[model samples]
Target: MRKSKLMVFIISVVVMSLLMVWDMPKVFDNINLGLDLQGGFEIVYEVSPLDGKSEIPEMSAVSKSISKRIDVLGVNEPSIMIEGENRIRVQLAGVQDQDQARRILSSTANMSFRDVNDNLLMDATVIKEGGATLAFQNGIPVVSLKIADQDKFYEVTKELATRGEGKNLIVTWLDFEEGVDSYAKEMEKVAKGEEPAYVSAASVREGINGDAVISGNFTDESARELADLINSGSLPVKMNELYSNVVSAELGEGAYEKTMIAGIIGYIAVVIFMIAMYRLPGVISAFMLFIYLWAVLKVYNLMGGVFTLPGIAALVMGAGMTVDANVITFERIKDELYKGRSVKKAFEEGSQMAFSSIFDSQFTTLIAALVMYWLGTGSVKGFATMLMITIVGTLLITVQVVKFLLGLLVSSGWLDNKKTWFGVSAKHLPDVAKGEERKYFGKFHNVDFMAIFKKVSLLPVAILVIAVAMGVFNSVSGNGFLNLGIDFASGTKITVQSDAPLTVDAIEDKFEEFGYQVSRVQLSGDNNEMASVSIKEVIETEDMYELKEALEAEYGYEPSDSVVTPVVGRELVRNALMACAVAWVAMLAYISFRFKFDYAISCIITLMHDVLLILAIYAIFRIEVESTLVAVVLSIIGYSINSSIVTFDRVREILDGKENAKNPKEYYKTVVNEALRNTGERSLITTITTALPLIALIFLGSPSITGFNTSMLVGILAGAFSSLFLAAPIWYTFRVNKKPTQKKQKNVKKLDEPTEINVPGINS
Candidate 1:
């Protein structure tokens, strides 16, 4: 209450100036562009070679080979990696034409050469069928072959020998750059009757098995083609494309525009509502809120945080929460004024009283955001990032920025005691009659502290037990953790827009026939204008074309484009884990610096609980552990922390009031109860506001978005519970010690009077 106006103004200016200097344009440029925003093609390829006969090692080898081939294609920032057991995802950025991409990608490069008149030469089948002999002569492995037409074979062999002079025939083991290469000189020396060479035509191996190995000047591409040809061979297992579509970057840009516009409009509306409802205090609060928004954007820009559609939505949601602290403070001030307290006394008491509520509410939100960042990936992570930033930004703006501004305004007599802003006047308000404060149930009872501690600890212990039990059951049941989405696990994703409605099951069945492990299929696009099918493995370009054709034939609608793929696998998982860990640690550091160590510890503990609980549920329910899960977990962390912080702020206030006190048990208890009681309504309101949009998203969003929503819904609810039950109780246990005193006895007596405890319209 005794804050310096000059100091407050200087701090605000300094913070604002710093934020402005940190690339304001870049910050407001819109959310970070996703793959969808940047034009690209994503394709999922199934790496199983002919039926299910391939071994894990063989499949792994094939995956490596295919990845090398895609890398050779030189797509910008291309992502080509394995996913799950036998899946490969390839993402090509800035690919405008799907047909060209498909053509390049689908052309099975089975590079093989034949005689001039099309006579049968060495092929991949020779090794598999006839078991060609390999012998070491002169310390060199000699691969010998026998052909049906010896004369024609000799001519081809001689040509190869002659061409071998200075060049080496590089037989890429599987066409990779690291494959084996043999010098043509060695073959020439043996063919020309010089002496036994590294490779001899002595017919040491026999049988016309349908092919022969050719080695020579094969550049990287040619080598790869040959390897692919040999590895794939000619097979009857043809691929049929299930669906494909071209996603226009224009759509993403449009979405970005609409989201920005909606956010601005919504923010403006909230500001207007606050000003009209609270008058001068509302105006000040609104200004502080604006500052909060600016700080969030600045921080986001400074940190290079990417904004997405969901991120934009989160920003809008955060805007609502940003003013919550101010509202609590203003309401308390009004209550004090109604009790006939002097303007200065009302302002002081109200701000002090509001701390608990504000901190609690914000802490809950912070916790939820943290959990989301931990468990989410991709766009969901983006949302979580924004939510977390906004919560922290709000704390700074509301607690420091707004509180200081309000103090300055009151001190400067800008808001006098006489003038009426909303309704009640300073003179007309009721006098503060002395009364007994209400006593909570069992507050004065001489209960055993140790017994209570044991009883309370049981809840967290039970949760831990349940979590462990579920984890064990999940491991034994063979229903591994959530089946991650493509954003995390990687695979093939195809979105098809049609004029008519289509069933997900029908499309899934069609894809299954094409030998695709169709994991998920759902209606996408506004008004069900499109259907998206995601599979466990990527589809080759040729297979994509085939699938598109099949769709056209069966569904009477041709796909507008070939499928696009994104890389998924170990690399993605590793990166996601690293990013989430970094975010969590960074959040902890920031919170520790902003608040006390105990508060930071409490926040982290609550966050961990929320995250673990979410994971436990996911493991229990067998939800797919995709990138969206990360988003949910991070969101939970942010929300839970927001609630905890509110309570801590109240504790700080109580500590400030009784600096000389030996024990702070009474202070902590009052703070906790007051914080929870005051902020309960706002907490419910904020939750509802956030929940409504998510509920809509669950019903209307794309499969990916719906998954994100589901995770968020669970996280939000868990975060709310953790804030009230877990965070506060834990904080009380850590900070307060039960001790009997005469002051406590006096307080208990004061609490027994009904007239002292009840505030009119409070329960109402």
Candidate 2:
């Protein structure tokens, strides 16, 4: 090995290590955590015009109002997005009280000042937006209000000041709803289920301008809470909370640590495997992998994406993909060396030839992810975002940067001494030829893909058949078509954190003792100290309130909860189904545009097969199909189409070579055969290499995203199998009878004489 190349590599490693320790963490800390990873509630509220109005209110003004409210609430990081024309989505991370948050967000805190005679003097229109704060007056607590309109406020105060000293007083009231400002009316409202709180009243001995501080009977906490709510500004329209969820801190922290561990372990395993497989090229791949991770995280920080548990799963998935790209490039290099090319020539041409397949594969996945991001919401959006970033980053770091660095080593003469460092044995090189070509990489590659395809295709079909029966059974068993999670189904779920570990039986017993039937029970957090207990029936808000109080008081358990109303539940299910379809069709269109129509048609069929088979598995197992399920299904589609695209790209390259040849060797069958042989190793290598990190996530990562990881795993394996055997064979069946033009033999070398090249289904 050349000392220069070795030193360069050593220096790069040291610099990356230093950057990882000192810079990456600092950059990553800038990444925001989602509600599921921090403790808080995410709610989507539908705003409506007043009861007598017929038109919808403007959403931009509503969003601004809610944003100011969240800022005043002192939330760590709150996100407010306007949907369509009149809906608002608010996500508050690290806020504990869900009930209080809902009240504060939806309540119209209409501040009013009335004279002591119970006559209204001024309304909230005169106050500046976000101009309320808790101040001190004469060493006592007071609520301060800033007036935006000096003339209006002064006119009101001047009238009040002219009254006798005993009657000249301004009383402040924060109305929870409209039309109630007096103490009597507020008391009457309080007699019902709701009430407006009285803030403070002050003497208006003189006209005031700019700001007014009212000192009264007030405590520090109450004064501050009222000030914050008042500063939030009143909503112009009524906000009805439609969907909401609160995540517990214990669960969030546990998921955080477990996912990080899964990432580190999975990454280390991938590094070890790469070095074992590709030697020096593997080391270069590892460096590029490091850089890829660093770059993606930095970009994520810059994009201001909120990191969720599912997003962590996406990042792990991304790492596996980076490994896949590295594997593809290195495998091509090995193929070149096996054909007797020198190290430098192999590296050069191999990277060049590998680009087409990689581009097609990555491009298909990117298209699907884009569709997912566009249609998905909340954490699903976050996952799709990371998926896109990962794909782009893989193309940059794994493909472009790895090749550049490996070329440096090759050019510096570090790789000139032996083929072992490049994972190519001396016997495989052409110079040692005992002549007649052999299987690729010392592995048997002469399987009859068409024949095997006909036989093996039935497995997924059979799985689909079973899946169909299972789905029918599930549908008939009073459970709709799938065991849907609360995210897509109507129910009340309470996630509880106790000082002690919770067992299913114990949880069931507790609910049973309380005369509440537990529909489902799941455990999370370290040592199983947390449990999510759900009830399928629609429990009243009052009942849920009593239950929460009882559980908290008696068991000292802190429970975060979610409720999906029937209307929203129906909408979720419909949208998720629609998203799955849209993702499939979008991929088909992109593939069709990029390649030929036949390849696109066959790829979508195999893609559908993969999706149906996964659904069948979920049905048989009664897995919950929730919002994240949509993300998982799309990711699988992405992966399935990706594998199919790789095979087709190879087929196209070969067909083009055949057409340009002076003499075409055989025709479509031979072309298809060679294409499959060339790509089968690349397919298998990618599948196995990508599965490494997922395996870690399945075992050691957050339990929440285990479904997503498992789905991707199944799809990847199925994709690799179908891409090599099914997709190509099916496409070949479409064009099997087409005749090729006669031409002279060109330089393209076919693999060693096949035991049997032509099969029954292909140009028999």
Candidate 3:
């Protein structure tokens, strides 16, 4: 502990902070943004098996083919994903010509050639893929096509040339359907417009092969257009629209700006609270907090991770976690200082004590993050990936780097007797025997949490039962398990644009008059100039335009609609359920390995309770359950585990350290109660710190994100409650008080009384 090391640590932190700010703009510019954050459209298309074909086209090949076609739109950084077996999801960001993009994407573009007698000849198969090139033929703009098989083309041309009875011609059709093949008829359904799909029919005086030119009064621009279309090739399989969404640039830009402001405000609020609560140590944490954000973003950029709205929220929330880690260490040090220990000695002991708690909390959350990455999709997947990366950054930055800096200051001996620096007032110090003194934040040390739980346990249990009943009734009533949002039910969502204010009632009335059952109506925009109307029943493409026009004519509102087919909706529901189950099991298994089966089961039960409570609230309130609900549920799992891990960590640490141990039945309650009390401050502060960022999201984020934030807020509260009152008490009951019938079912011998076993993580 020397002054030289302290100076070095201070210099390193300052320089890193300065460099981070200096390079932040460059990192921001390089960062990738998801369609939701960057204003674009995403579509999930199901590639149905072509007529007469028993099997569907290869999904990977289909994705690649679609990717090549999408590249023609010239949208930067388009993403193409193959989902399951027959679906391909395409996302194009910052695309303005949505109509053109849609048309080009779904078009069959199945080109063919025929003779004057309407006799079938060679089609695109005879032409090499991507072989079309613009050319000048006879001083006119023309499209050149290279033959894939010279012999087949020569034979066709020879046949045309021999038909010299004033009939020596070949015809070209962009979307040719002779109606012979049923698959061709299917293509007929997808290819039709005001502009003819035909390019030209030319007379052949002599037989030719290899390469030929087609000119049909096409200008230079039209020639290039034809060349590009031909080069992009044709769809290998018919793409059925499963789901599609279009977001305006204005909406995305506004969300980005507002979310940024909210994050900054939340960050400042947390920093101020930290400083006020812990004084100098809080200042040290704030400096490291700056570096935490900077380092996470820098790594995120390097990893080519896309930043979405939820992803941004994860970063802000991660800052809170970083602060929580710092606080845990700082609080322990303050406790030591109150016991009359020197600042240097306190730092040494406190840091070691805090390590186990920090490790358990971070790793449990990391399990959730990893599960999400493996199971989640689209922007949800992005959020999971970002969370995983941030967890690592938090551990390295706060757990390691912050510790190093704080230790350097302690080593320098500059903080020898500065008890006040850690928020320990002279009056707060205990007068007990030296080293035996203890200080508590509040005088609830003897409050029997278990006794209170015995009384209030009925609240959560009753609410849960009611929630399950409501879900059953709702499902049986045909609405769904919950009032599923359009995201979960495949249907059309029409985005109506108007400057005039409108009521949801009036909109619903209009839709009802049109024989449409309105599921829900959402208003957005700065002045509520947009109404997104959801229709549960699937509507035909032909009727979509008619409906849009009718609504516009009646209300002077221009409506653009996006559709999600029931197929994608079903898949989403399945995956969401699986993700929740897998995440919970993963956390349980991890805890079992780290601690014991008793703690694992208890933690899992608490986590499940928190999610059930969230679901119950959503159902009772008739809130829309969608993909974001999945995010909220999984996040609660993480938070719930985090709290339990911290508490259990302390429990294990204390029990292991006890040299004079008694029978488990004799001291179980005393030990368990002590563990919970020790970690009570950390659990409470961590929730508050993390919840602050989520509160910002609820108030300042985009309207689209309101449901997500509400779920998150509820989750934080539920996690805090369950971890404090439910987890340990429940575990104690499981370990110490199993009835005879329960023992028979569990296949364990009945015990005279529950006693602590010498398990690996249990006082081993």
Candidate 4:
């Protein structure tokens, strides 16, 4: 049986290895990269009625129209999303003709027929779907349209026929600019020796209405384009560009390469740390960690998901979480070995004992990820997706596979006397045969946590208060509490890259020469050859094109630009708040259902403390707060809850032995203090593992995500502090002060009988 177990372990490892080698490369190649990765353009349009008083068209119809236009552009997998009630966001990745794409996207295509008096006679409502086709008439290319309403066309022709021969001209106009284009205006322009705005004009002879031909001074290409545009259907409402982001392919490639390097560095550091700390079990964990990462990316590829910059960050964060679960189980196994259990028995009991905490942590984090996915949009949704995939992957691969491999190794009877292999020393072991009690195993085991909680608790509160005061003062002084990024502040950010080194003053001078004021300039890239300049004003489309041309002339290549309007900025703020609030409420409900109300309260308070501390740091340090801050806060909420739940689980376990003790309040203190002591190392280790990727990202990753990584690093440190010092103490305050009910007393007495405590584990 032992041989079979060993063989099965070997086979599993071999299978995982084979699968990774065969499909991992394919997964990387097939995964769709978002606009932020590949070079492309994204724009948000505010939809409004053509006339001032008409009701806005349905969002579905508008998106369908936009989708049709994108089809003409030949863009692969364009993303069109409706934001709020009146905005549509279109993302086209890897589009080459960005200028033409933007022009085609915003074109109204509102074809019209008017008489010499500039009176409207017919409109695009007569054209059938896909009815327009390019054709030849008398060796001249023209657009042919199958009119949906033949009777209306006949009436219009009959009315025009009543006018005099030379004056009875039916003028056809394409994209009739409201308040701008008219027959009189065109005639005036014609008289001034300029081109007319109308496409074509025809004299009405009879009321023939089966089909209509729009003949113009057209080449084959122009005629084909006009036919395609007509077939695509005119947008029911006018669209105003409110936000846009255009990235250069070179910048995207640089970002992807740098971020991947950072992630690899972080992953390696985490693996080395785990092996150094846990010995053999750490080796198994590191192996499973590789499998875990493969499974996540492979699954993402299978799902046909788009990979983005934030998605990469999510993957790095998942590595941290994967290591965290392993550390918890390994720590538990070491604790079991210290109690004089055999290697096999310690492996079994530790796996069982660690199950509840790991499950609780995973479950709570799942809640936060789900909330983020439900309420998030754009790249935020992408981050949430990667996070969810990692969580699911950890449960299926990290938790189960690691435990199985380690179980097989221990049960083979080859390491029966090798407890040191599991990282337990002879000096720390207690002999069960001699009736020596097992002392706590952590370095902090001898420290009195409750004795210092009173003082340490004050420090966070004081810091939070000062942070709030600073926020108020900053707000009152006309600057926002936190340094808002372009994502939240609604501005234009231009990224200019040069082969030679560039400075802020040089970039500022260039902008000044262009007659535009620069708000701020940040330098990045290895040699500081790239500069990101922010402008408070949203540059118009024509002006942006001119600026891009000028910068390209000055620099070597055209730069990337992102512009956001005030409307989208406001919407982002609202959605971010909603995402955070929904996450907190959802977590509170989940914890309350799994544990108790008081425990739920304590966990939530600690989570709030973590967020406040992170915000405080950002506000005090003037870190630019962007839309990704929502992601950071939500992620920290998940991380902090994991720690809080683990500690609470320990408190519950220790309290199981307190049924017969007098002075229950003092016992509560001991239970809480002991819980902190027991879980302190796990908390610290989790933070370190999680922070590894973030620190690497801050120093070595893409500048696009540097602020995001920095914010996450601060939140992680704050989460660890709250988990160890604040969470359980708050719970202790609630528990020690509450009076026990008769029913609760009965339950406690029922648990008094010595029976097997069924620890929820894989074996169970």
**Top candidate, metric lDDT:** 4
The numbered model that scores best in TM-score is 4
- Weakest 10 consecutive residues, lDDT, candidate 2? 657-666
Determine which window of 10 residues in candidate 4 has minimal summed lDDT: 742-751
The digit string of per-residue lDDT tens for model 2 on 453-562 reads 77887888788777778778867877767777666667888887777777899888877776887777867887788887877766787877887787787569746667
TM-score of each: 0.55, 0.87, 0.87, 0.87
**lDDT, model 1, position 558:** 62
Candidate 4 ranges with C-alpha deviation above 4 Å: 49-58, 96-99, 120-170, 175-180, 189-197, 200-225, 430-440, 497-499, 513-517, 522-530, 539-553, 556-562, 657-665, 740-764
Give the alpha carbon lDDT tens digit for every residue of 1-764 in model 3: 38689779879888988898899889878877777667788888878765567887678877877877787787777888777777788888888556777877877677888765556788789888788999996788999988889898998898789887647878787655555433233335437633344567678887896699888879987687778778888877788777888876656666677777777777787888888888888888887887788888889888877787668656755676677788789878876776677889899999988887788888888887877778877655776877777788878887898788888888888888677888777777765565546565444567777677789899898987888788889889986778887777677777776767667888899888879998878666676666768888778977887888888897785666677766666676577667767877887888888887788899988887897889889887788776666667666776678778878887677678453233554466776777777777777777878887778877987776677777888988999999888998888777665432333455678899888779787689
Model 4: per-residue lDDT, tens digit, 1-764? 88988899899989989998898888878878887667688889989988765798789999999999998888887889887789899989887455677778998888889888778888888888888898999899999989999999998898788888867898988777667777887888889988788988889887866998998889998788888887787888888988777766555666777887998898788889888888899889988888898899988988878888668767867877788888889998898888788888888888898888888888888878887788877766777889899988888889999988888888888678788888777778887788987864778888778778887988887887887788889999988877777767768978898999899999999999878878778666677787778887778999999999999998897787777666666676577668778887988898889788889899988888898888888877777776677768767777788888899989888876455347866878888878888888888888988888788888988886677788888888898888988898899899877777655444344565688667678436
- List all candidate RMSDs to the true structure: 15.4, 8.5, 6.9, 6.9
Q: Of 1 and 2, which scores higher on lDDT?
A: 2
